[model samples]
Target: MASIARRPDGKWRARYRDDDGKQHAKHFDRKGDAQKWLNEVTAAVVTGTYVDPNAGRLTLRDFYLEWKTRQVWAPTTLRAMDTAIRCCTFADTDLAKLRRSHVEQWVKTMTATLAASTIRTRVNNVRSVLRAAIRDRIIATDPSEAVTLPRQRRTEHAMRIPTPEQVGQVLTAAEDWFAPFVALAAFAGLRIGEASAVQVRDIDFLRRTLHVQRQVQNGPTGVEVSAPKYGSERKVYLPDALVTLLAQHIERVGVHGDDGWLFPGVPTSPRNMRRAFDRTCERVGLDLIPHDLRHFYASGLIAAGCDVVTVQRALGHAKATTTLNTYGHLWPTAEDRTRVAAADLMSTALDARGDQLGTAEG
Candidate 1:
């Protein structure tokens, strides 16, 4: 039930008790307005959608702090989200008062300085925070919804696959300790992080497969071993040559224990191999990132007539679409193969007709 009455200040006050027996009141200038507000609140309570107006007064920063504590994100993701929050313009604004214009303005401001991909990432982070606020009834609507973001442009130079000769040159120029790392990435399609985290126990000599279960990530705190990106734990087959090289390397390094890190550095850390990789690339007169080796591996698979699904599994991609988007250009087209097959079919038919004619004439 609800009640409306005149107050001492010449205002009408509406009062109601919620489902939990909590009393709430609001004052209006007119008795009709007070009555209308009371009716709306009572209906909302009966329908189980009532929200306490006072709860939404917290600023975005405060709400985000509360919301973030309850979330379980990967370390790298957590760092990115933290950066987004710290750099947001509306952090001090009230969650209830956020509007679409505010979000649009923020996007405009970010576009001036940040890359399109970076702006999208930061905006999405803020949008996710506000979405949680909506679920908690902190706001009636999400302001960040449908906000236009900067467009992302793909550049050809972003991903490059080196030729086999270039790969050979790089291997020849790399130090002995880092050569195996390059080989694993170039041949086995392992990301640099996954390659660095590989343990001796992860290799299956009999099956010639490497179990990719974890990756090394450098976070705000320090380097730590974490699950592979998107949990893409998969087994990638090893080439016979790579297997033999790994066996010889293991013997030479005198690493007898299965628990030892495949590429060991200081105590409790994987070796920082990027410096060595960069030096080797410079020596070999090639410009490449460590990840390019993984691209080279995919290109080789496609060149050797491997299907999309096989390449996807070899790369440990979470989705086939991801593999397609990254290396779709390298895959062979069905159109070309169809043309070749058509030509072969017509030639065979003509040859068979000639043979029948010769037999009939005889």
Candidate 2:
């Protein structure tokens, strides 16, 4: 049974014992308020949903720190989360007391200072923390769930994919050592990180395949080799021309052992090839980023009538939806194909009908 009494300080006090015989107490200014709280606590206990009041007293910062330590995030993800936590405004707010309005206001403030995508990411980070809090029974509901975010516009100019002819030009303009790197990105559709982490052994020349198992990322501490994004380790097929070019590249680089990096820089490290790629692009009069080469590869696959699953696999996308979302515009419209097929069928039927009528008349 729960009990309520007026304290000497003129505040009403409520006390209750949980199923485990753990006593809990809360003070309120009015007896009715104390009774209400006690009743809620008793109901929760009866429903086996009782959460210790003290568990949620910790500030958001405190809970996040505790939660962060238990998570195994990738290096880039860890850096992003750290940045989000540092930039969040409600670090001092109690986890239990945090309200939807507080999250909405935070989103508003963030919108004023950050890009739409960035604000969305940071808000997601906060939401992740709150979600953990809910799972731990520190809070009953997520405050960030109902918060509205700004829309992100997709611009065609965001990605500049070079044509096949332009790709050839860029490859020709690149230096001997750098040509292979460009080819890997444009042909094999490897991310820059995945390309950098490639070992000679990872390529099977006879099989004409490139295996992507890992990636190189530069984090706050330093360069680190980690799993590929979304754990999308996949094998991408290579054309005969690309395979021959890769063989020539290996010979030119004098890679004696299979363990050596396909594109090595300093002793036991991969080269940073961004500047070289940029210089080559400028020389060839093409406005392109290293990632645009990947887009070019996907475009080629799509143009060749590759299905969404094939394109997704070739690009090492974790989800087919991701491939569609990025390159859906490049796919041939089913409506257009349907119209053409319908016309051909109608024409054939009319010709057959006319021949039958002429034969019957004869």
Candidate 3:
């Protein structure tokens, strides 16, 4: 309930009790101003957009600290969220007073040095914090909601896909221990982390397949073994050549049991893997990372007439749209196929018509 009353000091007092039974009051010079304030509060309550008058005094960082504990983020995601929170410059600003200009300015500052996608992630992180505050009834609206963000380019053009020859050269030039690592990425389309976590038991020589179940990830603390990326746990078919290579690699490394790591003695971390991969690239005179090999594998699939869903499953992408977003350009255009099909049909019909006309004339 809300009411406007004339105070003993010749001022008007507008008072209301919130849903929680706590009362709030504002002193105004005129009775009209007091009633207007009550009307606004009553409308906000009716519309289910009411916020506690004093709750929004907490800063963004304060809310983030409380909000983070409730999130069930994966290790990589946790690290990324922490990074975004730390990087947010307006974390000290009060949620109620935080304006869209503040978010826009923060985005503008990031545009100078950060990529569009990176900036977008950071902005989204801050926005999530604001959205939580809204849900908690600390703020009425999200300041970051309407702020403009930098545009991210389509991945198909941005991704660097290495050629088959370059992939072969890298595989050949890689050191004995690292060759299998490169092969898994280039041939099987495993992420560096997933490849690093591959154990002997995960490989099936008879079926020529690799099971992806776990990954080595870098969390806030350090490197840790964890489940593969969401929807990334899958079985990937191996080519006969790749299967033979793995068998030889296992024998050479003296790996016997299912529990044995494929790259024994090497740290199962992306940093170590990248270091080894960089060395191999230098030896082969190619400028490429292990991830480029994954692109190489995906491009090979697309070139061999694999559909979007087929490539998505092969690469263990969580969604087919992710596959299409990154490699859609590699797929042949439907319009091109349609035009060819129409031309062939028209040509056959015309040829038959010409033969009939010639026979009639004869």
Candidate 4:
């Protein structure tokens, strides 16, 4: 039997103890609600699934802290993870006492405030912690996986994929400021840091390639030059236009071999190119960011009939999904490539002065 105590707020308190010699109490708005909760807790205890809140139990926040320390993520990445974890209402809730209902409510609250990507990131963080719990048998199942995920929102402000021609125009427009930046980003698909911190020696003109050995990072503590993001530290080929542009930039700026930084910054932080990029974009009449150039690059590769596997390697991405998710739209239609091949029978009729002839001639 359950005993109920009423408060001035018309709420009732339900009390129970578990086999672990731990006491639990909950306040409900109605006597019926109190009785129902008592039954639930009693049932949980009988099944050995009851969470003894009194047993110095760990909470969601506690689990996250433990898991975060074990991860070797970059400082920026860890900070982002911390932000995601803090947004959860269950961050401080007893991990053992946490139920599916508690997880669901937290998800709802997060969904109401965050974007799809933000929500996904936060949920993934929770999933990481809960998965470990599931593996350790702390919980019977992973509640994060069981809960429904919110739909990803596709907002207008999301990065835009530039057409091949537009990409050329943008580069031509910002010849001095962005041509090299655009080339490295579009042709080599280097992340901002990887590209910005590139040493003059990193450019292999003979092989038509660029080596990605390091990257610049701007974190809360300060700026630091570090290794590439994930396995992004690899070599990638460049297009003829970009190669020519890089060669010219080298000639104009002059390099002292591999030791000379390619695009030196004022504060010596190679990772701080966002402002320079934004200013260059304004001068070019294009409302695009440097990172958007990466999306445009992926889209261009896909449109140019490069396979996903090829794009993944070209961009130094650890996985094909990362390449596909960002620039899947660039994947050209099979028929489009087929039509170009099909038109090979009459090369003389369609060849003109200058239009992206949609030919494999490039």
Candidate 5:
């Protein structure tokens, strides 16, 4: 049964009941609004397709635990998700009673303070959480869906892709020991995690390629070597310049057999943060993220006039569309492509449609 009645606060409230013998009530600002809600609820209840918006009352901490356990992501990824969840206003609230207003306010506050990419990531994370809730049948409606997120502000820093000349200069400035490593990242576009775990044996000098089988990451348990970041483990082709650099670096540093790390930490560790990479960036004067080298690799490929599909393959992306979406903006327009424009395709169509005849008449 369903009906609308005025509450003590002088607002209309829709009252209903679930099959499990529990009363459900939803408040509205107006009587008509309450009646509309009651109509929808009663119609749904009659058809047995009604989804109780407040069916399972669980806390945010409960869902967080559920979400966290279900994630098969890397530890670093888990930590980031946990941190993002903590930053939410509902971090300590009941997930079952989570409101759209709370999410909107959070987005607004964060958008005013945080970077666009950061805000986007937070929105995505919240979406992920609500998606899981819906999948679990815990919630009938996703509150995150109603929330309006901020537009991604295209800042100069966001669009400023690293040029090859700048990349070469930065790598060149690195010390001899770190030079080859930096060059590898700049040229090959391997993530720092992948580069750090690269074994000496992974480099097939004769083949002119490096096998990217795993990655090194920092965790509470210390440095751990795990599979590639995207988990699409694949080999990276070495440019002639980088290949030559690697060959020389191997000979100079003396590779410790196949098991030894190519970019091994100085004190014979998988990750030697105490030396090699640390302070090297500070020394070099490049105010860039370590992972930006991957961008440098993608940007260079785009700049060299390589096809987006091939670049996607070289980067081992799961999809060519992914590569196109991320780095397509950095690609320069080709004169050859202009020759095959939509206008050219429309040439015959325009002629067939008598547009040519109209042009002559005009």
Candidate 6:
């Protein structure tokens, strides 16, 4: 129920009871203004888009903080989201007053200093907060719903996949203890964090497999063990050479127990690992990071005729699409397969005819 009445002070008061029976009132200088405000409220109610006048009083930052507590995001992701929210220009703006223009302006500001991917991450983080606000009825629509983002420039040349020869040189240049760690990434396709978390028992020498269970990540409380990215826990088969190398390293280093880390100490720290890897690459006269080894491993799988699903599983990707998107260029095209098949058919027919002629002549 809503009403407009003139008060003794000559001010027109508009009051209404919301869906929950809570009364909201506002005073205007003229009766038409009060009636117009009431009509808008009524129309909003009829359209089922009614947002309580007080609900949107919370600032974007306040809403983000509230929404953040309920997320099950990993510590790294939480840190990233926190950074993104903190960098928002409209962080102090009330959610009720936030418009698409504000979000667009934020994107424009970020594009000036941030990379395309970084800008997208920041924008997506804010978009998620606004979506939660909508679900909570703090706002009727997402301010970021129509905001434009910079295009992510990803091409085949963007990803650096180190050559097998270069990888071998780097592995050979590595110290005895570090060679096994390098092999796991280049041969077994484990991320540096996953490699750091590998236990002695996680390796099955007989089965020639490595079970990825967790990853060592930088959490809110410093270095901690957590589930793999996107929970991509799976077994990756090891090459015979890598299996032998790991066995020898384990024997020489001596693990404390079944739960002992495969490459303990400095190798587990991603920063230290990168430094060591950089040193090894310098010695081999190649420029590469440890992550480039993973690309090498994926490329090898594609060359060996592994399908998208097989490569995805080997690389511990959460989705087959992720595998295809990253390594699609490496896979053979349908035309290549067709040409190979046609050539093989022609060669077989020619060989058979020659054999028949030899038999008749005999």
The residue-by-residue lDDT of candidate 5 on 1-362, one tens digit each, is 66788989999888887777688898899999888988887877776556656644776657877778868887767877876788887766666677888788888888768887787787777678777776666766677785666666443346545566667666766777677667767788777677777777788888889988887777677776677767358878898888898888888976554577665452134355324555565676656655677787888787788998879877878888888778877766576567668668788787777976887899
Q: Per-residue alpha-carbon lDDT of model 1 for 157-258, expressed as tens digits? A: 567888889999998898776778889999998888888888778889899999999988766577888899884799989999998878887888744335
lDDT of 6 at 288: 88
How many clashes does each candidate structure show, in the order listed?
A: 0, 0, 0, 1, 1, 0
lDDT of 3 by residue, 1-362 (tens): 88888989999999999998999999999999899999999999999999998998999999998899999888788778778889888888888789988888899999999999999998888788888889889999988887888987778667898888888899889888889999999999999999988898899999999999999866556678889898999999999999999989888865633568887543366778889999989987988988898998999998898989999999999999988888888888989789989999999999999999999999
Rank by TM-score, descending? 3, 6, 2, 1, 5, 4
- Consecutive 10-residue window with the lowest summed lDDT within model 4: 263-272
Please report, in order, the local distance difference test score of every candidate based on alpha carbons: 0.84, 0.84, 0.88, 0.72, 0.73, 0.87
Clashing residue pairs in candidate 4, if any?
Answer: 61-91
Off by over 4 Å in 3: 219-221, 256-258, 346-362
TM-score of each: 0.82, 0.84, 0.90, 0.71, 0.73, 0.86
What tens digits encode model 4's per-residue C-alpha lDDT throughout 1-362? 45789988888988775555456789988899889888887777677665444432677777677767777887778877788677777778777677778778887887777777777877887777777765544565566666877876453346676667766767776646445776787667777877777777788889988889888777677767777878677888777878888888888865443468776552135444776666666776677767777877776776677888888887888999887776665566688679888888457455653345555457
Q: Which stretches of candidate 5 lie over 4 Å from their true place?
A: 1-49, 52-54, 111-113, 155-157, 256-258, 266-286, 332-336, 339-362
Whole-model lDDT, model 5: 0.73
Q: Which portions of model 2 show Cα errors greater than 4 Å?
A: 4-13, 19-21, 27-35, 43-50, 155-159, 256-258, 266-271, 346-362
Q: Please, what's the RMSD in Å of model 3?
A: 3.0
Instruction: State the local distance difference test value for candidate 4.
Output: 0.72
Best-to-worst order by lDDT is: 3, 6, 2, 1, 5, 4
Worst 10 residues of 3 by lDDT: 256-265
As for lDDT, the candidate ahead, 2 or 4, is 2
lDDT of prediction 1: 0.84
